[model samples]
Structures are given as structure tokens and as C-alpha cells.
Target: MSNDVKRPSGRHHGDLRRVLEEAALELVAEGGPKACTLAEVSRRAGVSVAAPYKHFADRDSLLAALVQKGYAEQRDRYVAAMKRKVEPAEQLAAFARAYVEFAAEQRPMFELTFAAGLDKTKYPELLNAGAELFEVLREPARNLRNTEAGSRDLVLAVAAAAHGLAVFVLEGVLLNVSQAKDLAASSARAIV
Candidate 1:
């Protein structure tokens, strides 16, 4: 069976780029960047194989755009998860849980965004998106720690612990559900 989902097929000429981007995202979500080809993305998007080149310079550029887009979605998820809690400490736990959930649910994107070894400096938009994503976590940490350095350290520690649990879940050493969530939350507590 094809991993390609049925995307909206009626993109106008001006929005063909969006169609291609959506198709590429589905391809990456299914099987990481290597598995996604411009030809395949065009096919899924109801465009010609040459269509992707019109929007993206090359595959790496498309992957970079995907990374940038993924960070935007990740930041939104973090904010929504953190909003449920009133306390800064609880917000930190929520961040960890949401991080783990994102990893488990979107493992391909998680790896692409973090471990793909892509040179983010070449992609300015991706770097900005990453900075914004980290700021989401740092927002809650700022309330808990007095100094800037301390807040940065606390956020890094929590994120590191959360990332470790997410890797465990992805590797199947831990379940991707509540157990992973509990571990992520508890690890954040321990870090702080």
C-alpha cells in the first residue's frame, strides 16, 4: 500500500508550491527525508515530476523547508500543552510530555529536525524556527529560575531528559503511550 494520503488535488497554478510542500510533508512523515523523492511528491500532489524543481531548488532545500515547517508545528503543540497548566513547574512537565508525544507520534519529523545532521546555518528560516521553538520552552523556565543562565540550564536539562525518553520510546525500549509520558514528566521533575 502507498503511504501517500489523498491530498487535495485542485491546487491552482499559484499554489502549486503549497501542494508540493504538503505532499512532501506526507512523504517525510511516512518514511523520513531519504524516502521522499521529488518525483514521488509531485505524483502525490497531482503534478508532474518536474514540478518540484520549480518550487524547490533541490531535495535538500525541500527537506530544510520541512524542518522549518515541523518546528512551527512543534512549537504550536508545546504552547497548547503548556497552556493547560497554571504553574510554571507544571508547565515544564507538560512541555516534557508534549515533547515525548510529538516524538512518538512524529518520529520521522523528530529525527529529521534533531538528528538528521542537516546544516541548519544554510537555512535561515529553519534556524529562526528552531530558536522560536526553544523560546517556547524557555518561556516557562524563566518563571522558575532567577538568573538567565539558570533558566537556560534548567530548560536544557529538561529538554535533554525528555529527548532521551523520546528516543527510548522510538526505539521500542519503552511504550509510546502513558509509560513514556510518565517517564518524561518524572524525568523533568528529577532534573529540576
Candidate 2:
């Protein structure tokens, strides 16, 4: 109802659900998950406040959808990054760098993706989407080690390292680094 609130740009007709999702993401991107409200999302999407109810039950449901979409996009980025390299080690490094860089670039969405109190049972799509990203990492990891147990362990280790780097960078613990990608590559190489 606030005329001053800006509507999200570049929306087109058809798929009102997608429009609402995009509007919600824009709100979250600008000011974290708490800033996203159904009213605000509907307003920004240029729909009546009641309209969002048709697509989502409430703000939490919308946030869950956003989390699901975020995981899918993040997985796509890792997959694309891996495709750019042919060697197994290079592909693993690419996945690490991509994971860290995505966290850096999409801070708000990144934070929301890992937000507390996320009930996966209520949102199985969120759970499944998140699991897919980890599955992508296992491919290169299997190449790094022969046995299934060894590859799974190596994948966990590599993923933990990359996630740690991302958290450190986002928290400003690694501000002096000249290039995050270089450090990520070096760290990944040490492991492989």
C-alpha cells in the first residue's frame, strides 16, 4: 500500500508465482530475510497484497521457496564452473572456488540459504535442492579417491574447507587476501 516502495523491475506477464518469488528475492537481497514480507513482496510485484496468498501461505513459505531456488541456482553455478575444466583436480578446484565465490557475491541469499529454524520436513523441495549441490561435488571427489568411502570422506573434507573459507571471507577474516580465487585454488590443490 506504500506508494513509495519501489516495484521490482523486469517482471513480465504470466507466471505470477515466479514474479512473486523474484520480488521476494529482491527484498531479501536488499535487506536479509527478515525484511521480506508478503505485503512487501506483493507490493513490489505490483500485485494486490491479497494476491500472494494464492501462491504462498505466508512469509515463511515464501522464504522456503527462495531457499529452494537459491540452492538450485548455486548448484547450477558449480556445475557450470566444473564444466569449464577437463581435469579432475581442476574440476574440484573450480567447484570449491565457485562455492566460495557464490557465497561472497550473494551474501543475503547465502545467509538465508543457511538460516536457522529451517524445517526441511515442511519444505522437502528445499532439502532435495540442497542435497543436489552436494551430489555435484561428489563426482570430482570420487575422481580424487578410489574407494567409495574414501571419496565420500574426501568430498566432505573439501566441502568443509571451501565452506570455511567462504564464511571467513564473508566475515572479513580474509580481507587482506589479494585474490580469493587464488587462495581457494591453492588450498584445493593442497588437498588433492
Candidate 3:
């Protein structure tokens, strides 16, 4: 059966780009980055295969846009998760949990966001958007009573641990670490 969910069939000429991007997102969500093709996105958006060329050069260009969109969403979630707690350590824990949860929940998008061959020079916006997630962690690390380098090191350590757990969850290799929140909270407690 076709996994393509029914999308808005009627789009204004000006909204085609947005429609195409939404279609591409759905495609990626269902089957990861390689599944997102310009032709498939156009068809899902109820447009001609040629339509996407007006907005995107090729599959990579569209994927780049998707990466930016994914980062922006992750960054927003990180900000909101951090705001729920006043304590720095709590906020850090929240950030870590959110990161891992995002990976598990939006597995395909998360995979594409970190995919190799994503040339940052060509897509600077993606880099800037992704940086926001790190900034949230950095803010909470300031309360750890460390020098600049020490704080940086702490943030990296925490991120590395969280990412490792997230990867394990995504790969389904670890049977014990099933819950993203619990694993993330445990890792956070150990560090903070």
C-alpha cells in the first residue's frame, strides 16, 4: 500500500514550495532521507515532477532544506524543554531528554539532520539552526562552576552520552535502554 498520506490537493501557486517541503518531510518521516525524491515530493504535493526544479535544484537541495527544518524544530523543542525547569541541572536534564526523545520520535528526520555529505558551506542556515540546541546546553552548564574550557568539556561530555544513548535506541541494539526519557535522566543525574 502507498504510505503517502493524503495532503492538501489544492495549493495556491505561491504555496507550492511549502507544499513540496511538507510532502518531502512526510516522505522522510516514513523512510529516511534516501526515500525523499523531488519527483515523489512533487507527486505527493499534487504537482508535476518538474515543479520542484523551480524551487530546488535536486534531491540534495531539498534534503538540505529538510535538514534545516528539522534542526529548527529540534532547537525549538530544546528551548521549550529547558524553560520548564528553573534549576540549571534540571534544565540540562530536560535538554538531554528532549534531544534523545527527538531522535527516537522523529527517527528519520533526526537521521537526515546528522547525515554526512551535508556540506555546511552550502547550507549555513542548517548549521546556525543546529547551533541553537547546543546553546541551550551551554546556558545550563554555566552553573556547573567550571572554567570556560571546563564548561565546554562538560557540555560535550553530556551531549556525547545523550547522543550515544539516542543512537543505541535508534539502532535497536540495546534491549535495556528502551525509554529515551529514563536513560537520558539517568545519564544526566550521573553527570549533573
- Reference-based lDDT, each prediction: 0.83, 0.80, 0.79
Candidate 2 lDDT over 1-192, as tens digits, reads: 897866455443467889898888788778777788888998888888888888788888888877877888898899999999988788888888987888888876787888635788888888888778878988888888898898888777777778888888888998733366667766777788
Candidate with the greatest lDDT versus the true structure = 1
Off by over 4 Å in 3: 1-8, 174-178
TM-score of each: 0.84, 0.81, 0.84
How far off is residue 191 in model 2, in Å? Answer: 2.1
Model 2 has an lDDT value of 0.80
Model 2: pairs clashing at backbone N, Cα or C within 3 Å: none
Model 1 weakest 10-residue run by lDDT = 3-12
* Per-residue lDDT of candidate 3, residues 1-192 (tens digit): 576765455653888888888888788777777788887888788888888989899888888887887888888888899899899878878878888888888877788888635788888887787677677678778888467776677788788878888888888865554476777867886887
Q: How far in Å is the alpha carbon of 87 misplaced in model 2?
A: 2.5
Better model by TM-score: candidate 1 vs candidate 2:
1
Model 1 misplaced stretches (Cα beyond 4 Å): 1-15
Ranking by lDDT: 1, 2, 3
